[model samples]
Target: MEMIVSFILAIVSYMLIDNVVLSRFYGICSFIGVGNKVKSAFSMGLAVTFVIMMATLVCYPLYFYVLVPAGIPFLDTLVYILVIASLVQIVGLFIKKTSPSLYKTLGIYLPLITTNCAVLGVVQTNSDSQLDFLTSLANGLGTSIGFLVVIVLFACMRERLNGYNIPKAMKGVPIALIVAALMAMAFMGFGGMVG
Candidate 1:
């Protein structure tokens, strides 16, 4: 179906081209903080993706069929954030209890994801677009894939950059920003291919 194809493209775009952290700069905190190593970055990416998908799944229906129809649309912003935060906490606790190793590896990143803009962004977008449940799930899946792909790619790039020599003015975050900007530019190549 057309929706399926669009969902696929959306996932591909988010994963390879419109990455939340690298492309849109949504969750720069985790992007920079957890990107020190591939393992940590992978964990962070998966955590964010999982949280975003869950948030969207819950938030979209609440906004469309509940809040809007009840004439309490003004409360949507607060409600959405509350839902996302609550869900993230629940998931974090569940993960911590169920998988101690993953919990240790994810460490603070799991909690840090509670306020990630990328997760909020997906929820808000899904609500605004009025996508059906299936489409929303597809969108969530796509966005997570995008985030995962970019974070992993960034982790590798950062690892490689560690051995490079650079001007003093362009060290640390400055160099990382420059590399990220270049990566975004490269992702633009996919724009034409999406539609």
Candidate 2:
């Protein structure tokens, strides 16, 4: 029972209170760049989620079993980056072959996942926190879900805002930035619940 409760709390905390994009501010580039359209945002979110999960699965073991024993912990960041980059390449090829339309829609943003801090952040967090495999998996999933949730919601809002007659000065990226800030503030409310 305690384990189950802990797992649930971990999910809630990562998914809501400590969201990667909204709370930690990781992956903001794609969050804002591709977020103007809901379909594209959703695709980017899934691609990010897939990379995070797969990278975590690979990275966690490599860090503990290989790096730690070798006394080369300093290489973790470099190694993690390589792992994520390779995974993204594989996923990109799969997406390209299976759904060329999504590949086109994602475009550069899909490749941008290679450098997305959020992916690195997840791997680094797992190593730093020293979480067991199950907890680390939970964290990865929750973080990706959080990313998906926020980007999709933001895209919907942007779609509506496009129809509104706003001030000339507050158009485009300016308004998007303001909305992102407001959303960040709103997500702050979840902090207390998790804490």
Candidate 3:
């Protein structure tokens, strides 16, 4: 019962209160860069989510069952990065094969997922904290979904911002950053709910 409750709490907390983008500020690169178009943002989100989840699936077991026992846990960061890079390549190939337009739209960002700190952070946090397998899985899934939600919403907001008459100084990245700060605050308000 306690484990189930912890799982549910982990999902909700990470998805909202402990958001990877807004609160943790891990994947701001894609959040601002690809968040201009709704379609592209959604695509990026899905891509990121896939990479994070897959990385978690492989990383958790590999770390606990393999790395720790091998007495070389210090190599975790390098190992995780390599794993993420491989997953990003797979996703890039799949996306390119199925949707060339999206592949082109995502362009460098597609491959950049390998460097996305959010993916690396979640995987590292799971291992560093020594969470059980199920809890670690929950944390990874929740954080990825949080990334998806925030990116899509930011994209939607940016799409609508075009209709508004904005000051010259507050245009482009400036306004986006302001909006993200506001979002971070709103998401942070939920933090006390979980803890």
Please list all clashing residue pairs in model 2, or write none if there are none.
none
In candidate 1, stretches whose alpha carbon ends up further than 4 angstroms from where it belongs are: none
lDDT of each: 0.79, 0.88, 0.88
| TM-score computed on alpha carbons, candidate 3 | 0.90
- Sort by lDDT, best first: what order? 2, 3, 1
Model 1, residue 133: distance off in Å is: 2.8
Models 1 onward score TM values of 0.91, 0.91, 0.90
| lDDT, residue 41, model 3 | 82
Q: Give the runs in model 3 whose Cα sits over 4 Å from its true position.
A: 97-108
* Candidate 2 per-residue lDDT over residues 120-189, each given as its tens digit: 9999999987889889988999999999999999999899898889899998888998999889899988
What does the lDDT read for residue 110 in candidate 1?
Answer: 71
